[model samples]
Target: MTETDIPALLALRDNPPFEKMHTVAISGMGPVGMVAALRLAQLGHDVIVFEALGGLSAEARASTFHPSSLELLEQLGVVEELHAVGLKAPIYQYRERSGAVLSQMDMTLLEGETAYPYRLQSEQNNLTEIILGKLQDMPNVTLRFNSPVARVERGDRHVRIHLEGGHRDEPILAQWMIACDGAASPTRKSLGIAFEGTTYDDRFLVISTTHEFREDLGEDLAYVSYIYDPTEWGVLLRTPNHWRALFPVTDAETDEEVMSAENMEARMQRLNPKDTPYEIVHRNVYAVNMRSASTYASGQVLLAGDAAHCNNPLGGMGMNSGIHDAWAAVECINAVLTEGVDATHAATLYSELRRDAAINHVQARAQKNYDNMRQDDDAARAEQADQLSAMDRDLFEKREHQRNSAMFTSLRLTLGRLKRELHAVKAPAVSGGQKFSKLLGQGPVYAAGAYDAVSAKLVEQAGFKAVYVPGSAVSASVMGQPDLGYIGLAEMAEAVRRITAATDLPVIVDGDTGYGGVLQAAEAVRRLEQVGAAGIQFEDQLAPKRCGHLAGKALVETEEMVAKVKIAVAERTSAVIIARTDAKGVEGFEGALARAAAYAEAGADLVFAEGVYSLEELTALRDAVRTVVGGRPLMVNLSEAGDSSALPPLELAHEAGVGFLIHPVSAVLAAAEGIAATYQRLLTTGASGKGQEDWKQFTTLLRQDEQLERASRLAAGEA
Candidate 1:
């Protein structure tokens, strides 16, 4: 049915009396706040929306609303109005730089899963206006433009909002307050909650034109397209009135150079090569950030939308997630007020659910979207294209992909968490240390090295017992540098956290020289344990230590190394501590055995005799350490190109009495080789050597279908 003829859908039902209802003060008049205010007013609560701006913005921002967001808008009674004005896009495409479509995603795969099976292309301002018009008719809704909140004071029963230049001279009071005040929220700052994450080095230039891109380029063009070009990756989206192109500008180019009339014209011409200069309607340059508030609630004040989390606009998830946050926050607030649930408890649950969604779903997805388009490596880009094409050809895979891209999975997960909370059902917790210990008890354990979460997932899929997070691998992959003690404890721990979060396998991290002396070692152990590390290996090397295989490495005194091991053992709760002695390369095998015995005496769970080159050397060292330390578990490094290059195979090492065998760089080396080959093929042939079937098999191994099943169960409230 046409949206203009859907009056029945837009009609509001009768609600409870508002005379005895409490008031809610919302600190922003953006789309999120407007939706929240309208929903609360519909539920018979008085709501006041305060906007710092004089009026709504005409600028283009966040133009795509996902299916999950459309469902919420439907609940708020504005979906019909939105449909009347906005454009519905059933497909989106990924294209090459020359405008050749490489892959296309059909949103129809989500037909049965969501009421609105396609994304809606509508400006943020359009939504705000429609919501405002409906709110003006409701007596319980009051919107005050140009009213900015200065500071908020939370009380026992209410919240006091001090205005900077509000409609009334006196402070405003409400039973609850919501801050939807954008990324740099004053309310969030006043509450002293940290907005933590990274900002992109490149700024995005959003240019809108009335010119018809589809007419010039082909009628087959989707409403939205991401063009992948190593030099100039950009995105194109069609609005009701205009088409917008988003281009990335690096710091190397000055703002004046990027925004100059000639440069802008040149960019448009390159996009389509039209004779006439593209008529510009609006243009804006803004920095994109991936940041989230540490907590979504502070006392009586709660944060929603951009105030709670902000991300790059690559995947069009920011606005949709914000709208979801609005509904969730209002629901939690309603539960507290009407259902007699404790306010603090409700707020805490809301914070946990929304914060996790923002971080894991919105931010992570947006970042990956940006990365996929902006990948500089030809081979990686081709591989990504192959994977997308594979998804396009497979029904189940496409449905799974649609679930994530359409934001249905995130909403389902959030609802599942809420359901579990309400039902008082707890999920089983998996302890990293316990898993590692279980594997250790089952005989010889071999761990594959991983530098990032993706690699860790590959290792887990390969059925590895554990993941070894080597310091050298982390330094090279994360920091793009050599592993000469350039990374600190915090950076390494964060990497460990990401890897551990991505896979269920136990992760053992490399703690280089424990980052410092005994105190630093203790703190490092504490931090690693907090991040769910299963084990940490500290080498007996001086500060600024080089890789064990590298030349010119120095060792710390045996007593000093023993002290650090003792401190690590004392500080960690359940994490296994492996003390690595590098004395074999410096002070010979006997000295290394002595240092190992000392570390064992200091309560080290495992002893690694680093730099053992040959089988004879390994066996002698292991026998001597066993004699000295009474059969303490020993770890052997079986590198393909490092100091242990001459070591025997895995079975041989196991037979030679090695409890743990780590191939620290084999995974990284294999990745480097595969990537180089793929890039070479793409550069030479302009096609990926890996076919669609190969990509389908690879993605299946990644368990994309299993993930979709879980999301489906959660959405059905079965999880």
Candidate 2:
């Protein structure tokens, strides 16, 4: 208000004082913001945390901490305090409105998979408060409450952070800044980043009461239960103090009308009637929106937690993903600050990892949960229930548990992808697509056929370069039919999924003639890539395509096949596209070679002329195709059923310039022979060869190794 103060402020704006410089200035002091602050302080970065609110927010939100969150909290040394006050909910249920338990999940099965196998049910504020306590004594940390960010300006070398509450004379200059502000981030808006997605028509209501559901719902009730009713689907969760229930309130009712005393009581009674008024602990109505920023980073400033993305909290992935984002942000920031990485490069890496986890995993799963919980179709509901209930088998249980616990999507897969992309650590384990992409230039890669997990594992154990999952073998094994396109996209994808999960080897899946057209072929490319196919081979044959070696196989027009190949290339996400032509059988050698060349021009990574006759012809075909494709690579499948069976030896084919050779039905044929012999001997002499594997070997292949190793350490007093 004074002339002297105006001049001082103008001077301050021009050049921030030395006292205002910090290593990092973070906006917001919520859970995500605090986690970043804690990590930065631990790493010796001078940190200043700004909170718009007076102190910690005590809103009744996000009480579930997943297994992966527990591990992360443990690393920060605050998990034990969380465990002390929180309830360990290891069992969650899915049920019908009539109280029929459709499915129940037991988290104890994850004992060996994670240290803390249960979800910790405590308010998120508890963890933030614990972190605050840890940060209070650190010399490098400053926690500023009620200090709203006035504006943020990104400069080339440093970011300027202006505080709103009585800090006009001071603007902090930070080496970098991270915005952990909540969903309605003005910072993101100021940077002109779009938060793009949909807002639901229904507003969700959360009513917490001391009224116990466990006492009324009987002994079979789980601490966490999702009750499905098309008209009034709801989620019931038992926190330490109260049973919290979430229900969707239609937009027909205004917020006040929906939250009226009469409406509230009636809703509670409708869910479970009580003779008296329910003891209400807390209630809130919030709009649910599934939205993510176009990009999480804007120049020198980065966004994390709810600032980067927010979604409907149906799957409890909201706060959990935010915390995961915090971890990721800190890691990326560490690279910039300590590892001498360029700031822009590190910021982009953070944006890709967190934004991907949000859009692909968190946002997608949450929307799916909302849809499934309120599913109206009777048959679809029944099928969903059956699928959930059917996750009782050990393999199914492990996979389901990992997915539900947020271990696979949020941590293992997403984080593994980040590590691989960074290539900063000794992290060899990466996404299969990356591994397969790296293997292309290396010559003479041979792939052995595998129809199942055991066969795929055996392929890896036998020192093969890759695993070849041919459609013919999958159709014969899974559907008991020849590869005449009887096996659909779903069936093939599932087989590919199982094989990819079973082995670390790059898998080349056979996509028989795209399954339909350019669009269907594009979908096939997406689905197969999703299930971890490193390379997908599509052949140039007409619908109901017979095996490539078969005589009755019809060839599609050369231009059409070329179009399909181009679509496959465009649709793929790092998967090698191999184009096969069965024209050698139908058309002559020159025709086949010409089609192959056309396909290569259409952007196929590998060219395959399916039925080449002799070694001399094959050699000439290889040289011609290689030259035409500019020496990318060529593929060949050596199966006894194929026309090339007469030209037997694999060594000679490699010498003929085959870059990738697949032993397409060899394992299936050998397995059939061995199994048939065992069955005959058992029928005749009453004894099966190797009557079941020794139980010990089976256990060793799975979860027993880590537990046994820990036990040995305990026994030896390794400390």
Candidate 3:
């Protein structure tokens, strides 16, 4: 077949030996970790859960569930079952110590707008048990107590986990590791991620009693009532046949003084009055702290649940936020396992999204809730409580504002900004010869306002192929050839497979002198052919080659390169083997030309006379190739420094007899120029806000007639 008529290359497919997960280890078995493991096992992946605690324990933590989180649980197919067991509290009452109800929130008003309008008041441990039941049913899931990962090791292909189980002193190896451990996690400590934040000075001495004051309350037993008086302020949450009450206690308060059953009964008597009859069931104490890890991912180790971020339970966001992290991690892991996007970057994105969400939305709101509770000065605290009460009332009853008060309004606005920030795409950096192609495709076009998708469309619109190198492009790197011998033999094979799948271009892959000496070069060439690469190029530079523009650049001996070229040509099955000479600028034009001629005589399919500085040099090299090999193809580097200013593509094809031109630095120039222009504009304005109106216009551009007209014209192919 003719060269232009060569068959269309199909995408390269990988059949990884570790195709299915057999033993998956999760470091934490908290609510998020437990739920995630259950979901993974439900999807048929063998799952192992490790918890520091020997068994599950009851805790009155994170009791309020948001409507969004409930919806998520429903999606996981567990919320309906959980809802059946938990009390759906539909209203919150704010009252003064004097027994006057200041304001009340009616969550039932949220009906029709959400599937679950009322917040569920089940203890977090109960929710954990619910998830545990679903997890236990999965045949592939194993729950191990008193077992934790000691360390983690990762390779290009798989991650090895070091496990310290309760029964065994020795460590066990697992295929993959997930650190879902809680806040103050050993796994996070091992990963070297910094947890940053402060613990509140206040703590809660929680008392559970079979309190029958529901009738004196004159409210639904499910209602969560907050006492607004500074000295007597606390929460009254109802559970089955028992009332779990939390009263704020200063850190200075002794545990003996706070935990005394007599003191607790007196506190309850002072708040509920009429000497309310009750039966104390259980009691505990907990401190509230809010912190965020500096990073969520370090190589193969990942942070999930409380290990990543901890929030105050005032707003009941702690466990709920952890659940969100679990969901986000699942999506990220799926992307890495299915798509070729780098695993590290994917993990980083997961951390960024989850951490930001918790810090900005959950933690901040929880702090506001704390402020409403712990403000000093009785009169000022009362005023703040009254405001919170009024806001809650307005939020529940005021339908015109969507029943949204200042709190919910700020929440919506914050969440809106978060969504916009999360959706913003960042353009990447490019350098070296790769910059040529980037500039040609994106620099000018993106300056004219085209990004990756638009730039690709522009290429398709201009009827040209748009190829991308996974990493930044280096000079003399092979285009179509597979195998990176400099890194490793196994890595070389994978790189070859990736390039095959990446593009259908006659891949001009740089073999860096065929992955070593002549024998290695021959074997690498054979592997490249087996992987379906169209061609391989061997550079004239000596081993451990540095960039051409750098100092102390060295060249391989001309005869040695010729020998490698001969070996490469003999080993290839259906691939072209091009020999490159990086000798033009290093040694004068004569040395480069002579090397090209020798390579051609040595049966090289194509010869590259790199660093040709002038049209005169290119002309001489072209003529020399004609003398030796007649009309064999010749590759040229159309660099800016090459002094080929007016040598357009058609002109080069017609006048120079050059078969290919590698304009690698074009995109890099365009990107750097655009970024610099933006920086300069920002400096001129003394701020980065002027173009915001334009950005808003672009974001909401459909409302503008001019934009709509342009869009319509573009849609109609009139642009």
Candidate 4:
């Protein structure tokens, strides 16, 4: 593909409808680059992507797509093609080098959770090629192959990038430049930013063996199978019809010295040492490194994919994380150019968000994996295994002890007594006819479907103070949640101030995880008070809180949560503080009640026990908290088909002497079921569209009217 082959641009003058003021030059036509370009094009931005190679990069780097990443591709219109060309791995297996059965983790465990519950095997080269094909069909996207940017200069409002292989010596000027230029980014280097991290000195020989192990390993052996041993460590993984073995190289030897086909077979013999016939067909050396950019964006120039961060492929995080970075970059860039918001602020947030996510989650997990794989000493391994066994045994012992211990029961009664004592403490009396109202939905609405119209219309017409979460086809599909933010105290206060700008309704701002530690919650409360929110509720769940509906969720320590409540209470000037406990399943009502009573003493205005199962539990809770909290509100998660007891929300609210009831997820829950159904239909039909004929019309309602109007004007100017 050449610049002249950009079919849409060649016909632009004839079309007369194709023109734009701000052109975003996306460097690199790799998967990350292509996805970003595609999203920008769909948003009616003029996108010119530069690729160094004549076509797609030929490196067979990433050979599989994670389910989460695949969902993003499904939104981008390439998931079907991926499934067609790629092998779906539904089962994961682990085995000892001596063919001993260890443990196998089946992806079937994730069957109902995600639409695509398995990984797909397809080379990154092919994936890039496919994305390039999609970009070619877009009228707003220009794919400039064999043209790499030699230099990038960022001015106050525009960016200038000089291409090496182009006909002209003149540089291309655009509003933004994204460097998806792979692991070694010259664009990033040109900005004088240092990538901070350590590169692993130890290398591994990655051999692609033609020998099929499926017959012996079983057809279901499509997984990340690790062969554990101190020395001669290896990992056997599937790639379509072939198998790849990763053999670790010792410290004294170099790749050339230890990775020949003969030596490869020898190492495999040492690790496997089995009767199964597996031979090396191809051998290559890989030096895994852990590195992240100090910054993701420098002025108008930004980084994505491997350019931003790279990690060892221990849990297949390296490539998947890059894909996530691509989605984030697209959202941030769109917010800047289209929304006319603070692009700099958005970029800073993006950098920190992606960088922290990769470092704390991916890099940390990779390091832990290395420890798990390279465990050498026999005594040490034995001790570790024994410790694991002991922990499992201890779980049973603890449960039995809890059942028998009089101390445990006495502790519960003492907490109950504390609750009664706190209840006796008089709450400020409600003045005659004095009204207090809590504004809900200060954040984005997540549910879609027919309910989307209901939720959107409700916010639009309710006269209730609220804000709309922007809806983008790419963002809405990939992030699996609406984008919402308050940034800092000032920004949050600004949001609250604006809600009252239109109406007098009190706002209930979603203070996600309290923004910081318990010590900081008070400061957050002070900030929220300035913003004009009447109340703020902080959850017991940890940061980057999983969607409240997901299972196997973990809650934070009870004491730490109580401390946060205390901080929130100490900090609040006017805004009411609500403490939400997610200890329903992770811990039972006893733990939940204990935490709630503690929070009331800490000065919480309301106590919320989420995920409660029955009226019996809800009644018990209301009776328990009434003693300590007094007339302060009690809130319960009102679920239609949820575990919040068989009691209706209003009746329960009245019975429990609860002052408030929050439907934190009513609209979202309804939206999820509908969006999920629509996704299923799209997957089955293999049709590319906005779903129903009226979907295009319906989506306009889903967006913030003013933002969409602004976007339409921008798109029109581009056309």
What C-alpha lDDT do the candidate models reach, one value each?
0.81, 0.79, 0.60, 0.61
lDDT of 1 by residue, 1-719 (tens): 12221122112112211111136889888888988998899988878888888987655788999998999899888999999989999999999988889989888878877888898999988999999899999998878888888888776445667778543323465668989988888888888899999899999988999999988889999999999888689999999889999999898988889888888888888777987889998888888899999999988788999999999999899889988888888887776666666677778888988999999998999898889888999889879988988877899988888889888888888777765674342223546875675455435567889988889998888767789999988888878888799999988999998998888889998999999999999999999989889999899999899988877888989899989999998898778789998888888877887887788788887888777645565566555553111122678776665645455554444444456767788888898899999999999999868998988887886788899999999999995
State the lDDT of candidate 4 residue by residue for 1-719, as single tens digits: 11222233223212322112235888887778887888788778878888888878776567768776777778888889878888877655445566554544445445554677667877777777777777788887778878877777776445767676544423565767889988788788778778889878778778787776766666656556766667755678877657788877766886777875567777766654557656566677877778889998899788888888888776666776777777767766776655555667666666776777677767887786676667887887677556544543565543332222111222233234433432233324321101122111111111111112245355545332332211111123334444232243444445445543443334555565676677666777777666555667787877545445557677778778888888887776656677877777677878877777777777776676666545566666655663222232466543443544444444333344444444444455556677777788789986534546466556555455667788999989953
Residue by residue across 91-175, what tens digits does model 2's lDDT show? 8888888888887778777788789878889988888889989999998898889888877877644676777755733456676
In angstroms, give how far residue 89 of model 3 lies from its true place: 0.5
- Residue 343 in model 3: shift from native, Å? 3.1
Indicate which candidate wins on TM-score. 2
Query: Candidate 4: what lDDT?
Result: 0.61
TM-scores, in order shown? 0.56, 0.57, 0.55, 0.52
Collision count of model 2: 0
What's the ranking of the predictions by TM-score, best on top?
A: 2, 1, 3, 4
Count of steric clashes across candidates, in order: 0, 0, 26, 13
Q: Highest lDDT: give the candidate number.
A: 1
TM-score of 4: 0.52
RMSD to the hidden true structure, all candidates: 29.3, 25.8, 20.1, 27.5
Winner of 2 and 4 under TM-score: 2
